[model samples]
Target: MKKTRIVILGAGYGGLMTVTRLQKQLNSDEAEIVIINKNEYHYETTWLHEASAGTLHHDRVRYDVTKVLNRNKVQFIQGEVLEVKAKENKVVLKDQEVSFDYLVIALGANAETFGIKGLDKYGYAITNVNAARRIREHIEYQFATYHTEEEKKDGRLTIVVAGAGFTGIEFLGELTNRIPELCKDYDIDQSKVRIVCVEASPAILPQFDRELVDYAVSLLESRGVEFHVGTAVQEAREDCVFIGKRGETPKELKANTLIWSAGVRGNAVIDNSGFENMRGRVKVNLDLRMPAFNNIFVIGDCSMIINEETNRPYPPTAQIAMQQGEVCARNIAKLIQGKTNLENFVFDDKGTVCSLGEDDAIGIVYGKKIKGTAASVMKKVVDDRALFMIGGTSLLLKKGKFNFF
Candidate 1:
């Protein structure tokens, strides 16, 4: 009999976790496992802000995939996935096509521009390792070029961040911390630099309680961060951004650097593959399988599940993706064993902790709200936990955040 071949796409949290669990449980006699990703390194999408702001080196946020993956149990392919032909059970890559008995799609998300004019050309988004590095270098370039200009434009020092959501708010936190270091290094007047955050929502971090939002706002404001809540980015021009109240005339905020952190949609491959998706995310069954296709499992930002309490879709998060991955591995194992041991994917709701730079944060755990240093510690612990979960103690000691002081 021919051996079953399982192909997993992308190496994000969900895909990696699924592979990690499956590798440990399965033997060569059962199935052959393959993981395809664009890069050999797996970077923490959650820590991109630090890299984008130059607070953390890009290397610190990513790791070589080979270190955690067992080559004997799993084959890792470094290739750009062009498309997935679900009907054919094949994934088309740039150089070759591979057929599989089962497919796991965890291709991740892309920056959502929301059809705003000029954003695609003018705005910067810290979506990946390269993007983060580019943003950091671009910001520094602007600071360095400021001194060389015969007529310095104040706008060069004005950095405007679009959105006050998770990515936006966290980026601002790191940027604020990074700005002082930049100003000194470049010999630029600290008072001349302006860091502004614009959000369309009524408040920043709307999911957080009002008290935490207020505290975060106040903390950032003291560090020279400006908040323009209840506003939207109308357009992004080459040297500035136009912002105003909804349905009103836009006013220009002259700034050379405009970073968009508003939202993200799932990988475009999802829609291209003919899966029924909203914003590139498929609404999956309780077992994390596409309704029409049981052999294909979707996870991470590419999969959607409803929150029974809210009667709406749960936000795509790393925490949720890893959980789905654990369940996904079990179901795949059951299939291999010729037993129906499929498990329903569940969001455990351990809690949430949002970092405010490296030293400050806010969180809710077990129904208890925390702030300041305590919250900061929790944030680091959460970040470290991800590394520990993937590669164990050695990897954790190598990449974990140990500065709790």
Candidate 2:
């Protein structure tokens, strides 16, 4: 008898966690597992901001995907996923099509532009390792060119970040730290450099309480960071951004570097596959399976679950995705065992931490609010814990953030 073939897509936190758990829970004869990813490695999506800001090297952000997989139980495939043929139970890749008895869609997300004009052409997004490296390189080029040209463009020194959300704020934090080094390296006056954050929301980090938000704003302000809260980015250009408050004329913020961290939608493959989605995210059943099919599951950014208390969809987060993966693995195992009952996914709210540079942060952990160095330490611990969960002690030590001080 042929074993059940399980196909998992993407090597992100969700997909990796699912595969790692499945390898341990099921025997070789029970299922044949195959994982596909566009790249041969998995990068910590949380660390992309640091890499984009040049504080952390891009190489340090990613690791070989095969390193964590048990070769005996899993086969790794490197290819871009084109689409999913749900009816046929086959996935179309660039090179070939693979059929599966069970399918897990965890293909992650795309940078959401929200119909903003010129953003696709003008703005840089910290989406992946290559994108992060591009932003770092582009920023350095602007700074390096600032002095050498006969007509110095002050716009080159101005950096506008489109969003004051978690990614935007964390990037601003790292950018502030990196600016000093850049000024020193380029022999430019630090005062001439500008770091501005534009948020559509009335306040920065809207999820955090007022106190934590205030602390974050004040700390960043001391470093010459400008906040334009209750403002929207109307448009992006090659050398400037148009932003404005409601009922006011949009003003141009002249800056060669426009980093967009405003929002993200789920992968296009989800929509292409004809699944009903909101911004490419499917609303899965409580068991984490796609509503129309029990053998198909969707997790991570590709799946959306409502927070009953707030009546809002829970933010697509690494913490939630990893939790979904744990539950997904168990459900798949039960199905393979010919069991009717499957475990329902209940998110254990661990908490949230938003970093401010390498040494500062703010968070609500276990219902307690924290900030400064203490919060920063907790941030590193959270990062390390993620590494531990997927690859255990060795992967943690190899890529963990050990510097709490």
Candidate 3:
């Protein structure tokens, strides 16, 4: 009898979790497992903000995929994903093709510009490892150039961040701390450098409680970060951005560097693959499979799970992705073992912690609100826990953030 073949696309949090769990549970005779990713290494998507701000080295965020995956049961393929031919049950890669009996699409997301003009060409998004590295180098270059130029453009020292969501706020937290160090190195006055966060909403971190949001905003402000709470970025230009409230005339804010952390949509392959989706994300079934195709599972940012309480979509986070991966893996294994019933994916609301640089943070954990050093400590714990989840003790000890105040 031929063995069951399971292929997972994109070794992100979801895909890696599924691969990790399935390999340990399934025997050699039952099935064959293969995971395809564009890169050989899997990086922590959460730690990207720190790397982008030059506060954390890019090397710390990623590790070789082989280090965690079992080679005997799981075959690792490194190739770019072109598209998934859902009707044919095959994946088209840049250089090859793969057929699957069971498929998991965990291809992750792309930065969404929301129809803002010039954003594509002028702004930077902290999307991946290479993108984060480019941002760190780009900011460093701007500071160094400003120091050497006889005539310095004020815009060279100005950074306009388009959103104050989780990514934007965390980046600002690191950037605020990094600026002083950069100023000392570049011989530039700290007063001359400006870090501005513009949000269309009335408050920063709209999802967080007002108390937490206020504390974060106040703390960032104390560090000389400016907030345009109700301002929207009308357009992005090479040298500046036009910003204004709903009915007001947009004013140009001269800024050479613009980072857009406003939003992200699912991977482009989801659309190209002809999945029934909105903005590249499939509204996955309770079993975490695409309703239109029973054999295919979609997880992580590429899949959408709606919140019944709020009548809205749950925000895609690493926590939820990991949960989905584990559930999806169990279901796949059950089906392989000739079982009929499959488990549903459920997201347990643990809490949320947003870091303010390395030493400070805000969180709501298990119904208790925390801030300052306490929250910061929790943030590191959460990060370490994630490492422990996928790669076990060795990975945690190897890449865990141990520092706490």
lDDT per residue as tens, model 1, 261-302: 988999989878888999989999999999998899999999
Query: Where does model 3 exceed 4 Å of error?
Result: 150-152, 403-405
lDDT per residue as tens, model 2, 309-333: 9999999999999999999999999
State the C-alpha lDDT per candidate.
0.91, 0.94, 0.93
Q: Please state the error at residue 3 of candidate 3 in Å.
A: 1.6
What is the TM-score (0 to 1) of candidate 2?
A: 0.98
Weakest ten-residue segment in model 1 by summed lDDT: 146-155
Cα error, residue 244 of model 2, in Å, equals 0.8
Point out the worst 10-residue segment of candidate 3 by lDDT: 147-156
Backbone clash count for every predicted candidate, in the order shown: 0, 0, 0
Write down the TM-score of every candidate.
Answer: 0.98, 0.98, 0.98
Candidate 1 — which residues are off by over 4 angstroms? 150-152, 403-405
Ranking of candidates on lDDT, top first: 2, 3, 1
